[model samples]
Target chain A: MKYSILASTLLLAGGVAVLSGCSQVQEPAGICNMSAIAAQRQLAAAPSRVQGGESPLLEMPLNSVSITDYSVINKLYVRTVNARRTPTGTVEVYAQIINCTDFPLNAEARTQFYDAGQAPSEPISAWKRFNLPARTSNTYQTQSIGTQSAAFYMVELRETK
Target chain B: MRRARALPLLVLASAFSLSACQTVQNTAGTPTQYLDPGSSGVVRGVGIEGQDIRSMSDEMMRDLLTVPALANASISPNVIVDAEYFQNESSSRINKNIITDRLRVDLNRASRGRMQFVGRQYADMVQSERNLNQAGVVSGGTIARTAGQLAGDYRLGGRITSIDARDPRSGMIERTHQITFEMVNLQNGQIIWSNYYDLRKAAQDDIIYR
Candidate 1:
């Protein structure tokens, strides 16, 4: 009777130990360390060709980098890009960010402007912050002072903890 | 004697088991790390912050770039920007120059000679230099000699005003700020380009705005 009781108690303890490990499985999802960067290239206006031709946007690239947070993937993304070169030979760009989350998020972003030679342009923009309300988005607009030198650009977003 | 030895061993075994339980259960303390302000600055009660300054100036720069008066073939219009016109009529006691300086410096860099800025704040130094040059104490470099100080084509001016209301029960303070920026054409005395940025902040009196 003693051996039987001890065996049953040991089995009960083993079962409790197995059940306790399940909570750890859920925690491995862990805290979100996810962020995304979007890049856009400014194309010269095609004055001769009709506007209905191949969109300059198709030539522009949408790059996703260092994505780890799957939970917030649908929560935010680059909506569109509008870019133009000024008569003064400088470039102006507007990057729209959309937030699909149900809560407000303070998103931060920075941009790198590059020359035609693929060399980084001077005075790379500092990281700028934006406040996004739930289910809404906003445009972050900036420009390259060296419009003649700027041929490419990249916009980066980071998990602003 | 045997009972005493057994008791010590039992206590040591219990200690090891308890430590194992603690190791398994102590996963709650996730540590925090510091982040750069340019990347992720700390946020306080909804107030004007470094992030706000960056975003505000960036938006203003973009808008100015769109307006021909500031960014087109208008080869560098001489302009004046100062805190006197960019007043803080809001409850927040922020330095008004912070806004104007950022806008001016960033625009100057990004405008690519499309916009020129004059420092009315340093008129004294300019007058001193011109006076010395006129007196022949110091020779003036030849560009195009002018009779007097160069006049600005447009004067960048605006006001930062606010409206404050209180929640009766919670006593929480909700403050709204309307920051307006305009570039007035000096010749015609008309506001050529004008826009306003708005922000609303609410919190208790204990919060600091800086």
Candidate 2:
């Protein structure tokens, strides 16, 4: 009887170990604490939310400038971004980009506007190209064209491709 | 000796036949991809492109909205946008309708009743329907018929011009395109609003724009 009980106990232990291993694999270790790169990818991969849909877990701040190309990050940076409504109620965004490198640089940028609820308000703006002299600042300006109120905006920049 | 010669000929024929039976690579061609119309597409040239048309029209549309006499007027002014007066003097071959059509459509949607657009291009069709209604061939519409078609207060007219330079030795070409957009007061013939877009591009060779 003791030998039989020992065998039964060993089998149970083996089964428990296999189940626990699976549980560990499926436990979602980094879900609550995602790295910055992973979080960025998640935010970009997620589709734009509808008007009343659930908000994204990660979102870039409103009226912010994002340098999407890492290669351009060290070469240039946005100095200031100003967004305000024009007299006609359209949202206008202006940004100043400063080139840090000693050589002249060409960069492109586009803007996406959002409504008060953080839903995209208008079609994204066309990519505007600008040339920056060495160690100089260049201004970039764009406005949203829609009847919908544009309460927020984000600008993305990359090296001219 | 004849059997030996026949064996050699058969071997040579078999070698040729075997070479003919070789397998081909059978590679696949590139799949089609959708690109944003507002961004630079894969095919580019030293002339005005689709992105240029979109960007320029968008910019002008926003500018037109900011004018007090147009968008925020007490009574929305009737505006007619068509390719009738818009001219293209550039070397690049582009359908002029592409620019005017986009501008009118986008402006009409964004205006949202703040401005009115007259269907001047469909005047003949509208006139035919009106004649039918009057002749009793078709029943009168539920709404009351007006005595005359709507008249436009403002009309859009523009011109596209370009300058081209070519290098003799390097075979390089440079092109500069200047497109001007203007809204004219139909009654006074005064240009109430005007804007222009300019771009310069240099390239060695480019794909044909069709």
**Maximum-TM-score candidate:** 2
Tens-digit lDDT track of model 2 for B1-210: 999989989999999999999998799878899987877788888988878888788788878888878888899999999999999999888889999998999899878888899999999999999999999999949979999999999999999999999998998999999998999999999999999988888888756878
What DockQ does every candidate get? 0.22, 0.33
Give the poorly placed runs of model 1, Cα more than 4 Å off: A1-71, A86-89, A126-131, A136-138, A158-161, B1-43, B136-145, B168-171
Q: What are the candidates' C-alpha RMSDs? A: 16.8, 16.8
Residue runs of model 2 more than 4 Å from their true location after superposition? A1-59, A146-148, B1-19, B22-28
Tens digit per residue, CA lDDT, model 2, A1-161: 99999999999999999989888854321122224433443233233467557656554466877888878866776668998777677878999988876688888888998888878888887788788888788998888875447888989988876
Residue pairs with clashing backbones, model 2: none
| Cα-based TM-score, every candidate | 0.64, 0.78
lDDT of 1 at A83: 72
lDDT per residue as tens, model 1, B1-210 = 999989989999999998887645546686686655444254566567676677678677766877766777536688887776676777777988889999988888777677788888888998998888889898857766578887888888888888888888888988888889998888998998888887776777556655
Which CAPRI category fits model 2? acceptable
